[model samples]
Target: MLKNIFMLFISQGVNYLVPLILVPYLVRTLGAESYGEFNLALSIILYGCLFIDFGFNLYTTGEISKTENKEKIRHLYTVTIASKFLIFFPVALIIIFTVNNVSQFDNIKSVCYILIIQMLSSVISTVWLYQGLEKIRIYSLVNVVVKLLMLPMIFTLVRDTNDINILATIQSVSFLLSALLLITIAKRYDIYLVKINFSDIRSILSSASHIFTGTISVSLYTMSTPIILGLVNTAFEVGQFSATDKIRGAFISIFLILSNVIYPRINKLKVDNEFLAFRFIKKITMIQFFLGLTFATAIYYSAPYIVINYLGSEFQESIDLLRLMSPMVILVPLSVILSNYVLLTWNYKKYYLCVPLITCIFHFSYIIPLSHYYGAIGSGIGILITEFISFSLLLIFSLKSGMLRKIYES
Candidate 1:
């Protein structure tokens, strides 16, 4: 577990650094307005990736941890890959139609289509297979290699606003290469590509459908922020919001990566002795709380400095927005633990879905109305509000379900 954590930490470091490096470069090269559009496009593209993934990362990983049967694993791989491929077509059509319909998508419209190729690459990547198997080295290596390879190309190819398509192309090609490499390495697992059928795909989907239900709500509240911000405000406002949000996001990803390490182990332990899982959760939650609080404090206090000196004055308005998002440092871990670790893992899909569903309703209500008066700050506040709401909902649901008691009293 420690080794898995360490490797994933390194993997996450590479992931974080690439975006950190890109944000500044992309912002400067594209200009604030164009960078804002880029972030919006990326956010929407992330939804594409998420849908194609369909919660397979969690569901399939858990399934893999439970079995060593190569044929079963192969079946899992085949169905998931087939499901992803089948879904991609309709999603692509929807995106194309929507992009063409919205004139705001005009400048970078082609880039949007190009970005879908990256999503397809993500579908083929077998990182989740290694993660569940506790063989994270290959997953980490592939990510680092891809990041390293993309670094120079990004610097060389993306020179101006007009080069948005070129930038998208570079990212897509790098992603495809990485995915293919992962698939090659995954051949060792005896993952069969030929034994897939429609029923197999349907079975895989049926099993993970609950996860997808919760994920859709969770993903909506997450991905809707940029969309709403773009709709209610100017590209400039979106740019500032995106810049600050990226910083807070990068920090929160640390806790998320920790979850990736623990999730599989706990699920495995859950098969034999749930007391172990509960104790594990408690110890880790304490660590997460401290790390989250420390991060929130550092970022809240340093928000102004980060926006002005570090990101330059083009992002000056991001200062207060960053401060508004500081609460996520603690809220993110709490919500993640409560919602994912307890709610979804326990198959309590109703309560799991409720937290995000209600949170999304509250967020949309606050964000949509408030953005009219308050802009990006309004959106940030809405996020903080949702965090509080989700934490409260998860706590209440977990207590009623007895998962909370197991964790605390065990």
Candidate 2:
């Protein structure tokens, strides 16, 4: 597991680096206003993607973990693909028409369309399938290949064009290519593309309900920032916040890699060695805490220089937000891992309700208002507070449920 985590980290690390390297070039070329417009469109498309995902990624992973039956897995994959395609078309059309009819964000309509296409391709890609099966090598390879291909395209096209449409085109192409690569790999593994099983669709949907809600809530939290910023503040503000966000997001990807690699192992441990599972959780949590704290501090202190140097002087304002939100860099990972742990343990349903509920409340009640008043700093504080609340709640629940006690006894 550790080795896999390490490799996945390297893979994602490369992926993260590409964006960091590209941000400066893109920002300098596109300017803050155009960048803001681009990010807003991306945010809309992202939410669209999340809506279409419908929690199948999590559901499929959990299902795959339970059974290695190739036929069943194939059926689940086929059903998921068919269901996603069915839902995606309408969702994509609604977004394009609604946004176009509303006539808002007129400047970036084409960009939004390209992003929707990217989202559709992303769903078809079944990238999560590789993660579900613990095929980190292929997963990592695909990720690195996409990033490598993107580097040249971004440099050549984005820097020269300064056209948000071109940037969107590059993104769409990248998604299509990555999806194709994953499909090829899946085929090579003899994961046949079976026909859709509508009968199983109902079962899949029922089992996936909570996961869907939780995932949607999470996505809302993620995509809401740009939307809110775009609505309440100037485009420049959105650009600044989005730039800072991209950096923070890159750091958070490390934790994502850790959680993804560990989730299946943790699930297996829950079935095979319950006591060991608790101990494992404790150990990883401690390590995550220190790692989070260390990196948060480093980023907090270094953000000003990093932003100014990498993203240009126009984005220097991002430093304050980065510093304020740096602590969340740690809490976010801890919260995610704990949430996954809770879900895999006995109280799976409860796990879904806890964090997402708190997070949703936190966003609306505190984060949104604070961000409105204080700008990006307020948003950072809101995230910090949200993660802190989530982490505390999960810890309390774990202790009260006797999972922590079991670890101690063992």
Candidate 3:
């Protein structure tokens, strides 16, 4: 398990690091205003992708966990690919049409088109199949290779200052390369194109319905920030917040790696030793508490230097936003891990419905008002408050239900 976790971490870490190194250049070249528009458009595409992905990734992983039958897994993979593609086409079309209708940002329409293509190709690749199969090593290697290949593109095409379309092109091509690599690698696992079966489709979709709800709710929390910011504030304001967020995202990557590492193990343990699962959750929660505090403090104190020195001085205003939002960086990992554990060990459907429903209410309620009054700063405060409430609720429920106690005892 540790080795698997390490491999996954290396993969995600490399992927995360590449963007961090490139972000400064990207920001400098694109300028904060353009970068803001670019990120806003990208955020919309990301949310669209989330909607396309629905719950298929998690649902597929759960399916693989239940049955080791190769043929069944293959069929499940095929159906998932088909389903996601079917969803992707319409979403991509909607995005394109929607972008065309928006007269405010002419340059952004092209960027959005590229993003839609990237998202479509990615869904077609069905990369999550490897996760479901527990092939962390292969998955990690594929990621590393893709990042390495993208280096030249970052260095040459995306120079200090370039057209936003060029940057968008690079982003799209990188995604295409990763998707192609996954497709080639997938063949080794015997996941090939096959005629879809209606019964299998029904089963996959039925299981995915719960997962879909959970994912959308989760997506609402994670993806709505940029959307909300864009809606309430200027594109330049969105850019500042997005740039700071890109940095904060790197910090959050550590927790994300940890959560991914433990989720499968928790699922496995829940079948026979619920106590072990509970203990694992407790241990992770405590670690997250301290780690969140440490990183939040470090980022808060260092934001000015980091933003001005590294990403350029134009983004100096982003420092305050970074500090205000840094604490949620910590809460996010704990919340994600706890939520996944709850979904896996308890009533997943109910868990999905409750958490996101609460989160959507608080997040929108706080963010909308705060953004209207104070712009980005208010938005940060709103996020911090929403996360605090949501995390507190999850922690309380975990304890009351004996989940945390069982985890600690184990």
Candidate 4:
């Protein structure tokens, strides 16, 4: 477990570091408006990604961890990929049609099309498989290498706003490269493609429906931020929000390292010994909360310094936005623990799904109005409120369902 965590840390370190270097340059070169345009396109494409993924990351990881049969694992692998592509075609068409027709997307229609390559790469990604198998060292290595490779290309090729296509192309190609490498390496784990019938795909999707809905509900506020802001606000504001969100996202990614590493372990423990799994959750929850508070406090206090040094004067708005979003660093970890570790692992998936559903209901009610009135800062408040509601709902649901009570009584 320590080894897996360390490897993921290194991988996430590169993931975070590359963006640390790349984003500043892109923002400086493209200017906030074009940079906002680029992120807006990427954000739209991520919806297609969510459709293609359809909660397979969490569902497959849990499924694969529980089973030992190579044939079953391979079957799951083939069906999952096949289902993604099945969903991909229609989603791709819809996204293309929407971007072309939508007034807001008029400026970034081409960039949106170019970023479809990244979506295709997301379809074939094998990180979930590697994580489930608890053999992610090579997977992490591939990510590190690909990110490093992207740095030089981006610096050399992306020099101006008109080069937005170049930036999208570079990101897409890098994603493809990483996906192909992971596919090759994952073959050793018995992850080869097999003949999957319609029934297989249907069954997998049916089983994953709740998981998929939960994923979408989570995305309602998370991924929809830039899109909503784009629709209601200006590009420059989206750029400012994007900057602070990037910094926030970097920290959240670091916090997720422990969650990812322990997910399969806890699933395995639940299978062998529920008591131990509960105990593990108890221990990790406290640890994760403390770690989250530390991160949130750090970001809150250092927001100005971080903004001044990393984002420059043009991005001064990001300081207050970053502070507004800092609390999410704490909330996200707690939410993950409650939903993934406590609820899902305990088989109270209804509550797990309900948490996000409930949050989304409240979020949509306020996010648009908030973004309409306050722009970046308004959206920041909406996000923080959303996270808090999610965490609170998860905690409440867990208690009402007696999951936490069981954790304590056991």
Worst 10 residues of 1 by lDDT: 188-197
lDDT of 2 by residue, 1-410 (tens): 66677778788878888888888887888888888889989988888888777877667776776678888878877877877787788788888886687545677788898787688886787855776787766778887888898889777866643468888988888888888888888888778678765777777777777887877776666678777767666677778888888888888778777766677777778889887877887788788889888989899889878888888888777888888778788878877765676544465567656668777777778766776787776766776776677778777877777666765565
RMSD of 4: 1.1
> Ranking by lDDT, best first?
4, 1, 2, 3
* Model 3 regions more than 4 Å off: 159-162
**TM-score, each model?**
0.97, 0.94, 0.93, 0.98
Model 2 spans > 4 angstroms off: 160-162, 408-410
Candidate 3 TM-score, true structure as reference: 0.93
RMSD of each: 1.4, 1.9, 2.0, 1.1
Q: Residues 1-410, candidate 4, lDDT per residue (tens digit)?
A: 88888888999999999999888898999999999999999999998999899989888988988888888889988999899989999999999999988898899999999999999998999888887888777788999999999999999999999999999999999999999999998786567988879999999999888888888999988999999999999999999999889999998888787677799999999889988888888888888789889999999999999998888889988989999998898899888888888887777878878888889999999999999999999999999999998998888988898888877766
Cα lDDT for residue 17, candidate 1: 92
lDDT of 3 by residue, 1-410 (tens): 77777887888779888888877877887787788888888888888888778787666776676667888888887898877776787888888887888665465787887777678766876656776677767768877988888877767876543477777777877787777888888887777777777776677777788777766876786687877777777877777888888888888888876655466666676776877667777777788889888998899898888888877888777878888888877888888866776644476456546777788777876677787777767777777887888888777777766666656666
lDDT of each: 0.83, 0.77, 0.76, 0.90
- Ranked by TM-score from best down, the candidates are 4, 1, 2, 3
lDDT measured at residue 319 in model 2 versus the true structure, 0 to 100: 81
User: Could you tell me which residue pairs clash in candidate 3?
Assistant: 278-407, 279-407, 279-408
Using lDDT, give the best candidate's number.
Answer: 4
Model 4 residue 388 lDDT?
90
Q: Candidate 4 versus the native: TM-score?
A: 0.98
- Looking at candidate 2, the ten consecutive residues that score lowest on lDDT are 343-352
Scored by Cα lDDT, where does model 2 land?
0.77
